[model samples]
Target: MTVSKKRTISDESRVFQEKWSHNYFFIQVKEKAICLICQESIAVMKEYNLKRHYSTKHAAKYDMIEEKLRIDKLALLMKNIQGLYLSLKTGHKDSEASIKASYIIAQKIVAKSKPFTDGEFIKECMEVSFEILCPAQKQIFSKLSLSGVTIARRIEELGTNIESTLKERISKFIFYSLALDESTDLSDTIQLAIFVRGVDSNFNITEELAALFPMKGTTKSCNIFNALKSTFNRFDIKLNNLSGVITDRAPSMIGKNEGLIALIKKEMGTCGALQLIQYHCIIHQENLCGKSVGFQTIMKDVVKIVNFVRSRALNHREFKNFRSEIDAEQGDLIYFTDVR
Candidate 1:
């Protein structure tokens, strides 16, 4: 047999042959090559695996551009957050300080981030800004923490002390007129205020607040008498020097047999008793007679129109513009006054 010259295998051919043989052996042995990206692999190369590998290991050049874009977007978001935070802090500085500080810190966080672009990010910043700007809710919590009964008792004690001090000073006046009135607050709490009218050294009517008390009931004459007597005793006021009592013509005050006037007269034996005088309050009489009917009606009508206009979006804008114009012309508008 002619010995054929041994054919030399090229380096690439040899390497290919070795790789093919290794792959064949691995398949026969049921072994697999692990993908670096996903950590699992099939016998054949997967497109997703290949892409992942390229992205993780060979994408350094493209990553620089992506990172720069991300940083710029983040910076923009941060700037917006900073602006919102500053606005909120400035708005609430008068109402709450601690809340403003927290908002400022949050704003700094957003500002420090690289620029970014995402509607969600902007929306989140806006939400946080609104939360910071909301009125302080902690005030209600603080008020709720106070003891209601204790607060009421303290107020009563203060009123009593004030009444006592006023009485002591008033004892110097030889003659004084006691004016009693009942009024109701917004909460409908009945309050009785006493006023003292006497001539001072300068011969001027020196009117002063003498006492104030919460009335038990509107129609209870006995309660009123007892309250008045207790107040007098508390202030060490002698019934002998009590000059005259001026009050409205209310049934509880001036009723014939069971009223405060009758009780005081019985106690002082009629001669040393308090002189009862009926005086109608001018303000109360005016209110009852509807004296400012036209003025009040006009004011109410104007307010209603203004409110109606403000309720609509377009009208509100128009109203604001009109208000600015009116303010500009206000200096030229002369207010007429009657000097009679």
Candidate 2:
């Protein structure tokens, strides 16, 4: 009973057996092999070749997707660094961490471009790289604080420019008037106020504050004149353009022979310097008239009688009662006036 001598397998069957037994990659389907894991027949190709195809093509697609993501992250980092550079250029105060973060982002951008071996070259590139990202309206100084010296220097510069502009316009005017006044404040500091009036090219009267100076001595005509001359020279205003002067009739301002008006006329000319019209202050004149001898004498007896009653506390009550009785009969108090 030779049982067909254990049907010896051929070379083809041996080769097939060997190939089937060898390790073969498989395609992932739902995290497992599609045919074997799901128990389905892969009619087109063997499991090994299918797995090789899926790995080479599908796995490569994943690598490309990851590379794209990395590139996008680098681009975002560069954009953030540019924003921080702009903020610094505009003098915006940033935290140390913020600066370091921006620097790191910039370093990453630089490093990824090429492998920088030289330290100096790398530093130079970093310095120049962020400069172009600076904002257009960059501030040289921060607005946080300013020293007194800085403020004063700026003011001096502005004043010099203004003075230069004014000098050019001053020569264009032919005639000008000067008005002077003195005032004392609550601090008892005397201020000399000066104003200049002139007609512009349009022939309209223009008044401007010429100068405000501290009075060193008494407001004398000579002192004021000297100050005016000095101020005019400082501002480059020509004295030959002086045509008129106006001042109040105070003794120092309008003394008969020695006053501001007299001094100006003496220095300049009578044609260019003339006294202003006298319109006496009505309130001051009224006060003086009330204290005149005629009005004082008329009120003297009434004042004495009132003071006699006011001096005694008991007589004051009786005086008030008497006055009330007289007022009651008079219907209302009447004030008499003299037409003259």
TM-score per prediction, in order, is 0.36, 0.40
Output the worst ten-in-a-row residue range by lDDT, candidate 2: 16-25
- Candidate 2 has which clashing residue pairs, if any? none
lDDT of each: 0.55, 0.56
Q: Residue 80's C-alpha lDDT in candidate 2?
A: 60
Measured with C-alpha atoms, the lDDT of residue 136 in candidate 2 is: 39
Whose lDDT is greatest here?
Answer: 2
Clashes of 2: 0
Which 10 consecutive positions of candidate 1 have the poorest summed lDDT? 20-29
Residue-wise C-alpha lDDT for candidate 1, range 145-264, written one tens digit per residue? 113333344345555666666766666655666677788878788888877776435555557776677875664778777777776676665666566777776788888898777777
